[model samples]
Target: MVDTVSEGGAPRRGRFIVLEGLDASGKSTQVDRLAAWLETRGSHVHVTAEPTSGPIGSLIRQSFAGRVPLDDRVIAALFVADRIDHLTNARDGVLGFLERGIDVVSDRYVLSSLAYQSGDVGMEWVLHANEVATRLLRPDLTIYLDLPPAAALRRLETRRGIPDRFEELERLTRAYADYELAIEMLHEKDSIVRIAATGTPDEVAERVRAAVAGEL
Candidate 1:
């Protein structure tokens, strides 16, 4: 469902794009670049991340850190709850910007839910939960930055801050393998364009932009 809005008394609608991958897959960098490129191209754009840093997002983050221990199913539900809130806010935020003809892009979306939760449950269940939670707000395009587990670990090591519990996960080989499986599952029904995330930021962003545009 699309929420149309008017910015400064001008009417417009926004396009929703999602970028997904495991940690260090260069999602953040590419999301930012896409938003900037969209703006430069005269499109109004808003960039956001999940867990959204909102109240729901905060709880999910805490749960992730083991600060608040919840069952895996509950944790998955919390993540979806955060998306409902984030999407609402994102809708409102984008509508205002879209009224000015802006596009909205997200660093991580339902795909992340599928990848992470698929590890816990079946891909079908993860997809079902996300579908129910998002009210089926599918992204127009999903750019999956595919990186090998070792390369991802390299990027993780160079990351500036202490790793979060998920980042500290040493079973990344399993997680990565799980991600690949999730990708296959999603490709069954959506436009999931895979890009090599093994290059420089600009290079990866270039590949992503090309893939997004090509898919769109």
Candidate 2:
């Protein structure tokens, strides 16, 4: 395991990296690529995603499928609950891995909640709900894959054959606007970097690597 010791007696925590973007922004693909790259460089990496594979996540998935009819505020609340569980679960959780000196890379994080949920619920309420989660598990780095809403919709249509609740053109346009506001509202602007996602997977990966070159 990699050594992480702070000036104090306690061990320094491992890095927490997050990938955020609208639907079909290639965040999932790049999360895997970044994890593989970190492993090759001898880092013990733990990869996870928000809307985690837990009870809350299950409800979120059902909501997406129109099976679970939750209001926007309830959906956002479930996201926060799942995120807390993902962080605090003793086994197979993000914090557990990080405490053991393993770097964590998440496919999506609080920024995504801010972007998507804020569109449905008002920004003030969404931000308040996420405040505790963000304080507890803020990413060390957040790479935003920037793509046009129309382009993202085309990609989803071509790849998935069916669109999910959040993949529509109008919602995506609004989500992008919320993302901009979220980025600006973040306490540390330097923690986030945007990369154009208008190229092949390999090309986008290259830009992601370049953006976090120093950390790597």
Candidate 3:
């Protein structure tokens, strides 16, 4: 197990690292790579993602699947609620693992919310909606795997038949732009890192590893 207690025996909280990017920017692949690398260095790791399997998260998924209809404002609110549960729930929550010294790597977080919902509901509202979650549990590091929307769409085309609503070039492009605003809004307590998510996966992984070295 990764060491949780200091020399004085006080428990040290584990790092919360979140990866953010467009749909096909390889965030999931990088999340797995990062967790494995951390494990080799003796840190226990938990891999998780937003739109969790919880009740609230399930609703969010249904909305995404078009099985449930939701307005932009409602979707934004749901995200915040799901995130609150992810942080403070009594079981299997991010904070629970952090308290036990297991590093938590999430596929996405508040950044995703801002980048996605802001285009429709307005940036100010999205930011305010997430303010509580941001304060509830700030990520130690948020790695943005930066990639052009066109490039990301090309990558998505290789693997999927139908395009997800989120994968549209216009939506992806707006999300890419919104991320800049989101990052700017979060600099105070959020350690945001941008990695050029180009070239091969191995090359991108190297950049991610280098960016995470300070946290090790």
Error of 1 at 27 (Å): 0.8
The sequence of per-residue lDDT tens digits that candidate 3 reaches over residues 1-216 is 456667778667889999999998999999999999988877889999998899999998888767789987888899989999999889899999998878999999999998998998998988788888877889999999999999988888788454555867899999999998888988776899999999888999999989999655
TM-score of each: 0.84, 0.92, 0.94
- The list of candidate 2 runs beyond 4 A from truth reads 1-12, 187-190
What does candidate 2's lDDT look like per residue over 97-205, in tens digits?
8887788999998889889998788788887887777777778889999999999988888874445689789999999999999899884653898999989999999
List the global CA lDDT of all models: 0.75, 0.86, 0.89
- Model 1 lDDT tens row, 155-180: 89897855665664555666777778
Scored by lDDT, model 2 comes in at 0.86
Winning candidate number (lDDT): 3
For residue 75, what is the lDDT in candidate 1?
78
In TM-score terms, candidate 3 sits at: 0.94
Local error of candidate 2 at 39, Å? 0.8
Q: How far is candidate 2 from the true structure (C-alpha RMSD, Å)?
A: 2.2
User: How far off is residue 46 in model 3, in Å?
Assistant: 0.7
